[model samples]
Target: MAQKNIVVIGAGFAGVYATKKLARKLKHNNDVTITLIDKHSYFTYMTELHEIAANRVAEDAIQYDLHRLFGRRKNVNLVTDTVTTIDRDQHLVKTKHGAYPYDYVILGIGSEPNDFGTPGVKEHGFTLGSWESAIQLKQHITDVVRRGAVEHDPKKRQALLSIVVVGSGFTGTETIGELRDWRDQLAKENKLDPEEIKFSLMEMAPTIMNMLDRSDAAKAEKYMQKRGIAVMKNTGVVGVHEDHVDLKDGSTFPTATLIWTAGVKASDQAAQFGLTQGRGGRIAVNAQMQSQDDDQIYVVGDVSYFAGNSDRGEPQIVQGAEASAQTALSNIIKQINGQAADVAYKASYSGFMVSLGSRYGVANLMGIFHLSGFFAMLMKHLVNMLYFVQIFSGYYLFQYVMHEFFRTQNDRNLMRGHLSRQGNVLWAVPSRIFLGAMWLVDCAYKVSGKESWFVDKLRLPFSWLQPAATSGASAAGADTTSAATGAAASGAADTATTAAKSVFSLSYQYGKDPMMVFDQMPHWMYSITKVLIPNQQVAFFMQKSMTIIEILIGLALVAGLFTWVSGGVSVMFTLIFCLSGMFYWVNIWMIPMAIAVMNGSGRAFGLDKWVVPYLQKVFGKWWYGQPQSLYGQDTVK
Candidate 1:
């Protein structure tokens, strides 16, 4: 008796789990052999990538060994290689290294970042679409920060700190928010000035997080703004230079760090497989999670677009990828058993969660839940833990906890010696170089009052608002209106003009509002107040009370301690003690949380870990001491 062969492409969440389920279901029969083919041996847990870049969590924490993941499966064989082509007629698949015959094939190769014809983006910017990219970004960030520490010039330092994340979509917006926080922590840990750090998230679209409801998008914008992240809406990167990004609005943002997450497109590999692909090059898959034209082949994740009323009929997210894999797995098992089992892959994400560093985050579930402070931070940690537990089971859970506990101890040793050397441009000579040439060209334009060849090629438009000094009021007077009733007309015109300006200003303000932390404070307070106050609605009364209580208790504790120790309370000394204590435990924790819920726990993964270690390796004795020494030179005593 011969065995049936089933080959599944991609080792992502869908492919890996699908393989496991299929193998388990067909194990008893011993009549089916499941072959899992992927470009990588291991499946990447992509959700925690922001933490990796920030160095809050280690790479190995989220990434699982493929063999380890499927060690118990007797009927499954994992093949590590890229699948180059798929032949439907012959039921064969060609790989980069070899070829395999398949009774049924599953395509779940996943997705890649869309450059969208932006010049120099692929050559310059980094996108967080993959583990390798995350690692690269982490290394680059570490190098940039270290270099910033040693840089002599202020302008160059600012540029090194200037991190512009393109695309205000979920991945772009969330990733940039995390980067902002990581920079802040890195700055504090390294004794770098907060003023020197610059982070921006730009989008060409009218708004960000477009998939969310309008209100949520508005809230997200406000949150981004509160953290001082420059939200350049209705603006996009048109060109990427070595040190600057040319925007669609004819402006250039000088930055050394450019992270592109603006858009996503399907892999070119889909076309090679001869699957029917639509907009964004995503393969069109049918109800069984199989390719429409080829029943044996299945496509999952962002690489394949599946239609569904679930999730509001939008495109699939990370959750959808997992769902697709599960469905494909069941169908594969049914086909192997010659059972009439057909299931349509349906995915509806419960909600979305975005973590802003360790303490701050946002979750949109049943209703808009704006999480911050300890609870929100806790949620972020729990989410990370849940992801690991869900994917690899309890095996990595204990290790993750233990690794976090010992992380700070190891971090202390690593935080000392080395200065960051990442993405540090030594000179602004390029700016000056371009500026000088532009000035010369401007001079020529002034002298000749004519368009240059390059200008003509660019099809650049001239400024209609150019000052009257050049064209004079004679050129503008034609647009002026004459008034019949001077006083009344003036008043009416003024009123109308004022109203128009107000409307325009309001719209502009709304558009300019950046996504950041603390924007949800009012809403959160309002919700709490609705429950707390009986007679009148009070905003933030609880937080205010907590702060006051913390202060008073701190004072009482100080007084009591002094009475016990020396039998007398020194008023000035007692006040100082109380204030310092409040600042340390309550104020420090409360304010940042109230603004954004982030904690310095398992959330950090990449640059922070590498930079801290690299610093300790280089600085040795001069390195900053353990986490306790961060507040002051001495311990609590």
Candidate 2:
């Protein structure tokens, strides 16, 4: 069998998914080689570029290493080089490094911002296209805010604080939404009046998010307006200068920043390929996503223009890119297997979700269901989690949740665009001291108790170890021990017997000893806990180790050493105690506090402020001992 070269160009949403699918589909075929080529060494979550630009997320949060993405795929070879041209006649792709021939090619190179020949827009307007661009924009925003803080002249200060976003589409809306929150925080931190910060989202169309239903668009606009973002409808930017944007209405708004999210067009390579170019310079493709001129070459993502079966053309969104990639990959596989390329692209538009800052969002589901407020925010998170699950491991999803959602203070500080030198000192010190004191007190209580506090308190939750007597005699014995009168004793005995039998019988049957623990917990919880720690010896070891762990957690928190690890461990222990029915109310409180401490709470006051750096120097950036700043300096201790 001759080895067939299958080359995937670009590492965007469509390209990455197509490569992964190809790798899975052809893993068993020894006669096929899959090569993924991208100019960048990492894949950026382009959808989250707004978060990056707003400084709401760490740059690392949106980037996943390309090598790590394909580390487990034996047949996939990643090439980090720019694609210069494609020779359809010779079945080869030319790169800056070299030329490579391929049996099948998939292009998902994505698109770049279209300036539309607007004067000064290309040179002055910042874009949210790539990681570098997003970072640069973030820096520019930070610089403007910093400059605004000291500028005495109101006019100059206003110009420094104002931002004009050209377009009210998803990217533009999200960008301005994040900026709204960021600007407010910046104003507060700089001691400037928040009213001075100006935000404008301009759209040439009558409404924002025109692709969405009118109701959803209206909801988004209302949310934006409520957040103080000026939604300038039926407005277009004729020109963008260094310090002002010239609107088509002959109005000039003084702004230091102009974000160009108006539109994107296919990469220049699309036009250079000599293929049939369609609208927006995108390569024209058939229903199967194959090039109009060459069946062997398939184009997907924003770079592909498909005049589909419907009146509307395919959208240049992630969903459309994924759908096109699937269709193209399927056709390529079919052709490889000596079958007809018949599969057509079928877009699955589940819904659209737009986040209005941190906690607010609006979403339209399947053009039928509409949601707003926390539910919409939750849906947006779930969608992002789904994407994370697809590209990375469950651990990555956990990290994403921890970094993006759980740690609010840290995220806010990040969004504010600067890490103060004394930032950690302000919050981490008090939190660490308090959390450490609580842990130490808990350890003392556990150790001072007579009898193995571990067995009496923690182990008592599992009825499987010590079965309770359900006999009526046991209940009668309890009544007699109470020393009641004859008639009262009889009545009390009956009541005690009924209650004892009810609780004991259930516990024995279901392995739940709620009598000594939290009686409020559901029966299923006991069943789960019992199944997880069924072994007596294992349970005993865990019970004994908890006290020691508590002591160590106290010491670590007090010393401000390995605060995140200790705090996470503390959270785990607290959860275990709650599940085992130890201290329900106390554990609940401890859980949240423990989470707070996990965000590098000890960095400012505890030894971690200096210890972390020293350890990083000694250990050379080992995952566990990195500097506290690695987790975000503004993170709670």
Candidate 3:
């Protein structure tokens, strides 16, 4: 068989997704090689670009390293170069560095800001079309604010502080929302009142969020108005300048920062690719996502115009992009296997979610349920996570959580800084020690426990572990008093006597002393234990093993070594006990303590500080390929 070269262009949502799927599906096939080419090395989370533009998150928060993404795939090659043109006649993709031949090509070059021939937009307006553009917008705002702070002239200061966003779609609405929330904090830092800065959303349409239901749009508009943003409807920008924007209604807004998020069209570069172009300069693709003019070439994302067995063409949204990519990739894989390229894309849109800043949002779910405010924001985050899981690993998911909730500054994210208010892990040292001490105390009593545990104690068993010496003890339906007396009488049983009741028992009486025998245990819960512990020998072995594990867990916690391992064990044991009808009402704090400590709490004044790094450097990969930097840097290749 001849070698097959599958080339994926652009690293946007659809491009990266198609590349990842193709690589994974063809990983074992030595004859196929997947090349993912992009101008940028990292994939940007386009939905969250507003965060960067509004300075809500760090500039790099929305990026995923492309190298790390394909690290484990031997059949994949990542090319970081500008794709200048595609020679469809020769089946070649020409980049700045070189030209490569391809057996199959998936074109998902994404979109560019459509100035709609509006004069001065490209020259004077800021855009959120790409990561560079977002960073540029943020920097420009920072510079303008810095100048505005010191400017004494009232008109000049107002102009310098004014920010006008022209558009009311997802990008424009979200950009304004984030700016509205962040403006106050930014103004105070620059020694100006937030009111001195003006924020506006100019929409040429009668209302904003035209794609959303009218009611949902109204809800979003209400939220914007409440946030102190001026909503100007039936407004059109005729021209944008360095410090002012001229409107069609003979109105003008003097502003140094004019962000254009009104519209976008397919990348103009595609027009030169010699593909059959359609509406918006998007390549015309069939229902199978293959180019109408060329069956070997497929188009996806915003650059592909496909009606796809529907009345309207697929809207240029994230869902449409990914769905189209799936169809394109599927057809290519089929054709590669000598099968008909017949997989057709049927547009199935669930709904849309638009965040009104990080704290609030509105969503129309399943084309049925309409949600607004906090729940809507939560839904949006969940949807983002679910989508991320498809293309990335848990490594990115954890990063997403950290960026959106725990690491976000000034309560600018959905969690509103509740999770962000983290203190030194060293402060948890005392609590860690306390938890370890409780486990040790529990293990002490179990090691000297009667009958079963005595068999394994040093191979001869502790004398204190023996049953009480009372004559009537066996017939008295178990007397804990006699057991204690016998334990105290043995001088070596001091450790056992000190902890008469296990710390886990917490003195909760379930119609009797729960520690003695776990009386009134649930039948269903103990069914498995009963079968496994049928004989005295197995029971004794289990008892001894449990005792050793508990002791080891305790020591590890106290010394702060492998806390994730020990803490995980502690939680499992605690859950086992609780499930076994062991009432631990008073000592239930151990569960949460164990869970909390698992988050690298051992790094503080403990061996884990040294051990974890060594493990990550040497034996770092999770059986899957992600680096084992749980709470450290993502040093992915």
Point to the candidate with the largest lDDT.
3
Which parts of model 2 have CA positions greater than 4 angstroms off? 145-158, 189-191, 310-312, 407-515, 518-637
Candidate 2 lDDT tens digits, 1-637: 6779998999999998899889989999989988888887777889889888887777788886665567677898777787888988888988877677899999989989887899998788898888899999999998898898899898888888899999877788888988887876788778888888889998998878876788878888888888789988899899888888898899988998999999888888787777898888999899999999988899999999899855346888888888999999999889889899999888798988887776677889998889987788778888877866665445457756755764445345323313223244446567777788888886675676574556644444454554463222222212223445773666566556445644433224465322323432334665566576676776777777777888888889888899889889988877655555454342365667777777667776677779888876675434323222211112246
Ranking by lDDT: 3, 2, 1
What lDDT does the true structure give each of the candidates?
Answer: 0.60, 0.76, 0.81
lDDT of 3 by residue, 152-190 (tens): 998888899999999998999999999888898888889
Off by over 4 Å in 1: 152-154, 188-191, 308-314, 366-392, 399-637
What lDDT does candidate 1 reach at residue 302? 71
Ranking by TM-score: 3, 2, 1
Per-residue lDDT over 144-178 for candidate 1, one digit per residue giving the tens place of the 0 to 100 score: 77777778887777777788889877678768777
Q: lDDT score of model 3?
A: 0.81
**Model 2 alpha-carbon miss at residue 300, Å:** 0.8
The alpha-carbon deviation from the true structure for residue 325 of candidate 2, after best TM-score superposition, in angstroms, is 1.2
TM-score of 3: 0.84
Q: In model 1, which range of ten residues has the least summed lDDT? A: 594-603
